[model samples]
Target: MDSFDEAVDSVREAIDRGDNVAVVSDPYGGRDAVADEAEEYTLGVERISFSSVAEADGYEMSFGGQVCVVEGCRYLYTRRVDGFAPVKSFLQTVVESDATFVTTWNSYAWSYAAQATEVDDIFDDVRVPSLSSAEIAELLSSDYDISEFLTDYEEVTADESPSLRERLPFERLRFGIEEASDNVFEKISGMSRGNPGVARAVFESRSWQTDDEPLDLSYDDAFALYVVVSKERVSRDVLRRVVSPDSLETSLRKLSDSGVVGFDGDEVVLRPQQFADAVSYLERRRLVW
Candidate 1:
């Protein structure tokens, strides 16, 4: 496996050579990190976030020589294709002109566009992978020293907290949780499916204990919430099929109480991170089918 720097450097080389790169990363994980790293390669970097076609239009008048870092392209219209035209037009400008286009995308958005549009055909797309264990160690050892914690310690302080890393915080979370128990990390690894965004999401929302007292929760209730999240915007009809009719409403209510899920009369929804974490949690517990 290429070291993180090696992988990043390869992309940096392309941008310096005036080649546009479409960086696809799992949601909320690597795109921003890649964009941040772009500054090291280019003399000047111009960052822009466009919500719609109208916004994309203004891009032409903005700047000239700097390498333009474009983000929120996935926000064109949620599906990443329906609203890609305007941005595509703007990007065409980047192509014909001298400016370099360093674009970023959410994995899901890129996946959809790949199937439905010429997005994949039009650009050089690269998917960033999660760092390896040794890579993680090599990367974070200098910034953190967790050796003392292998044996019991008084308590972890903010300075020593593994959560403090601004980038790849979730990767360190794996090592930290593993320090508590190897078995827990194994489940987290499998649950994340090696995706950093998914892994970090699991870490942030995990509330396995509070003062050594587990929250008042049952496997079934947690399972109910998991189903809700995995399905994405679960409806009452679908909820009835997964949950028993007798306890359907009660189970739903309990899941909502868990704070990981939100339910309006219309549907049950999970925040992006919560959704990924719940999927991992349920899979680890063997609660998913």
Candidate 2:
């Protein structure tokens, strides 16, 4: 079975044993998908989603339900020294409650929380594994006509023209050139490090012929990007709390201009399509683990 299916099965088994489950994955790595599939397999699961610590602070667990699925549990805390109060309170409630809970967490946030609060001891973890190359190909093919793109295994001279197949009229819209190579998906999977979301982003970048230049970031900017990636999506206020305020504005502006991050009103988010590139840049600088 695929990793997602395996995770769902794990969740089912955990629930059957009356155990709370923690579904952990990288940002956009299908934690929600696994949780949703697990929830659908059972009936009468109470679903709750938290976008911020403030929202989590006001939530009260319902003793009436036997199963509950909590999405976005990563939002319950920030990286600041004093930011874990909401998550601590929430975890205390979960420990005290009798209901079995399925909580989804960003892997980075889970790592920090595990170290700080020993949350790994409370919930049975079901980690979502990264997609394989074949899986990545299947996923992209479902949503796109990837046959039109140039393949990595194919070779062509600089003066080579389109083949006869490229001259035919097509009903579906096409991007980039025709003639797909067999190794294109492999290249994408490697570049994305098996992350489905990042693979898709890389595929789109390749298919659309958009080139991403290497990023040159100051230490301040790199640190900021690291925090943003770890948090998944953080508010401007929370970001300021974790990063140095002196260079916060400059770092944010540089990141925003480079298309590594985007703003949603008061919140800053690493753009889904740019995730792989941003992570690669950060990793090279040892800013992200």
Candidate 3:
């Protein structure tokens, strides 16, 4: 079976054995898809979605001996040292209650929480797998009538010119292509690291290539980017507490100018279209594992 079906079966088996389940994935990974699919197998289970940490405060899970699916469990806390109180309390309630809880979390947040708290002991994790090249192609084909994927030649150097057939990246043109291969999808999948959302964004345009020069971030800026990505969407106040206060503002300004991140009122978030590029940049610098 495919990854989605395997994830659903894992959840079903865990529930059958009376174990709490934790659905984990990277930011913009397919956590929601797996959780939603699994929820369908859970007849009569109540699903509660927490949009923010404040929404989870004092929320008791009293479902009268039924299963409960908690979506957006990643939003239950920030990455700050002091910000875990809300999620800790929420997890405590889950452990003490009679309801079988199936929760979803961002993989990075889950990794940190598992290290710092008893989260690893409380839930059995079912991690969402990265999409294969074929899977990425299928996902893109569903939305766009992609008859052919031409190879991009903009980056080719004069000294090392490639034949039209050997160029791999998808060209912007949609029609009148003479050849087709899996190379284009493989390139996209590799660049996106097989994250579907990132793959889709990369397919639309080469987002990593900005008019501005390539990113040259300092350690503080890189760390700040890591924190923002890990939390998905973090409030500026909470972000300040976690990153170096002296350079936080400057770091954010640089990232914003590079179009790597954006602001939503008081919250800072990684730009969805730039997600793959940002993550790749971080991984290269050893800022993210």
Top candidate on TM-score is 2
lDDT of 3 at 78: 68
Each model's lDDT: 0.55, 0.74, 0.73
Collision pairs in model 2: 151-181
In the order shown, the candidates' Cα RMSDs to the true structure are: 9.6, 8.8, 7.5
What is candidate 2's local distance difference test score?
0.74
TM-score of each: 0.57, 0.82, 0.80
Query: In candidate 3, what are the lDDT values of residues 1-289, reduced to their tens digit?
Result: 1776687789888888878999998888888887787677768788888765556655665675477888878667765667778778888788788777889998877887788788889999998877655566678778665565533322211224433533435421111131122356656666666678877877787543333356889988998998888777777876777799899999999999988799999888877667766776787898665
| Superposition TM-score, candidate 3 onto the true structure | 0.80
What is the C-alpha lDDT profile of model 1 across 1-289, one tens digit per residue?
2644555775798786877778777554566777778866668788877643345444553676568888765543222224456556655676576777777776655666566566666567767876443333333234345354322222222233334322445654553454343333333333444445554554455422222222255676765665554344556665565566578778777666655577766677655434445545565676543
Kindly list the per-residue Cα lDDT of model 2 for residues 51-133, writing each as its tens digit.
76557755665656788899988878776776777777778888888888899998877877788786788887889987655
Write the number of the candidate with greater lDDT, choosing between 1 and 3. Answer: 3
Supply candidate 3's per-residue lDDT for 107: 83
Q: Total clashing residue pairs per candidate?
A: 0, 1, 0
